[model samples]
Target: MSASETTSRRQVGWGIVLMLGASVCYALMGVSVKIAGRDLPLLTLLLGRSAMLVVASFLLLKFRGSPARPGNPRLILGRSATGFVAMGFYYYAITQIPLANAVTLQFMSPLFVAFFSAKLLGERVGTTLLLCIVLAGIGATLVVAPDLSTFGGDSLFALAAAVLAGVAYVMVRELRKTDTPETIVFNFAVFSLVFSSPAVFLLDRVPTPVEFAALVGTGLFAFGGQILMTYSYRLLEVAFASVFSYSTVLFSALFGFVALGEQPTLLAALGAALIVGTGVIVSVAERVPPAP
Candidate 1:
């Protein structure tokens, strides 16, 4: 009858579907942030988002009054550390790289997820998932294919984001055993505030009405997505949840075209198709027997 127990009892298919919906909403958050324009620095946006998330967490606790604290403050603190590192990298990378390239590379987090799941979660890795990994790498390559001519620095930023995001996600995967979504997200906001303290002086300008809205959206969307994702893990294995996450790519691409006018080339499109196909396969891949 506990929240964790309720989560664990939900059907895997439904959990995944919910996560997918969360992913789609997350992608739209990007679009909304874009609409707010470059006048709002990424750190400022992150800072505002952090404040909103912490408030949201407190409200959730006050409203339910359930025995919701995950009982391990240390675990929550650790997740906060990972969020600090991951969001720092992600916010920086997105600023440096083309949206498409950054998102493509970010998807590579699934590879790290699968590998970590096998080593940390003791899940058996299979050939199907392995191929999926290869395919996702190829897709990421395609996103940066344009840079092959000029060898842009965006690739570096994008890849760094990808790596750090994976590390943060592994932290999330670990935290799930001890913390609830509310705790994890609450910690994220706390860390964001702590991390942004040094840069507070730079935010001398008052955030525009639009910028404020975007920051609020970032908190709400990101928190909601995290909640759905937490519920998702309770239903299925890590790798499945990770791969299902790539649905964000499609929405990202669409948003890029519509909002930022960053159009993808035919090659990029082809590569994304392959990557998406691979992601789907990996998400649904069967757990193969161990090498006998």
Candidate 2:
């Protein structure tokens, strides 16, 4: 392979590693939100999380010497608007549903990303990618096993969150044309604060000391995950990066089992296996040359 090819492969490898770390960070955010207790309103938790994102984003900007303003303001705002709404619904679902189930539902965003990237970015979704996505969808369906018996508002919210998140991620892929990761995150933080603030006014009850700390932890993990994910997308295709995001579902299952005392059903466990298998398939597919 040529030197440029070698460097590109190396960057892609590192991007995958960063995204895996981001998956872990994001999974842990759910644990923190769960621990923060149900008394904290969704918007209030978002307020705290966005506040920390603001602080972390600004510090990152200063450290990197990147400008605070996004080069493409309209795209950044659209990304932020979608992200803010997605996260609001995601947080609400997290508080009401089992962590693993909630995550699996939202994890459907990857399929949407693949679809939209093909349509909007003109990124090719080959036969292999299509098959992998189909397998992943089957796995996700097994994990959720959605039925009237188990379905509720939380499920609806999680699905909405996934769609919005998919849109936001595609916007991120586009914005990376001109925006730094930190600037993208800063704009997201600003818009999250602006959009979630009004709901905070209706929320009652201050967080206890432990709840307060967990809330802060949510933001810290969120910032780390957001920045890592943003950079990962910059290095790799959105659809490709999204394949690795399945790791978040695995991490969420583990966290739910350990922290929340939620045990996965046998079917869910098998589904998790398929999810992991798809990640492995995606990794291998990237490295292997196509048949002549």
* Candidate with maximal lDDT: 2
Q: Write the per-residue lDDT of candidate 1 for residues 1-292, one digit (tens) a residue.
A: 8875444444655766876887776676666555543676767767766777778877775665623455667766666776576666665556665666566666677778788778877766677767776676776567558745543665565566666666666666666667666666666677778887665787777877877787788777777776676666656666666766776766777778887887777877877787678756654555432111
The runs of at least 3 residues in candidate 2 whose Cα sits more than 4 Å from the true structure, single-residue gaps closed, are 144-149, 287-292
Q: In model 1, what is the error at residue 142, expressed in angstroms?
A: 3.1
Worst 10 residues of 2 by lDDT: 283-292
Candidate 2, pairs of clashing residues: none
Which predicted model would earn the best TM-score?
2
Across residues 102-158, which tens digit of lDDT does each residue of candidate 2 receive? 787888899899989889988777787778887887777776563325667778998
Q: What is the model-wide C-alpha lDDT for candidate 1? A: 0.67
Q: Candidate 1 has which clashing residue pairs, if any?
A: none
In each prediction, how many residue pairs overlap at the backbone (N, C-alpha, C within less than 3 A)?
0, 0
Q: Which TM-score value belongs to model 1?
A: 0.82
| Local lDDT at 23 for model 2 | 92
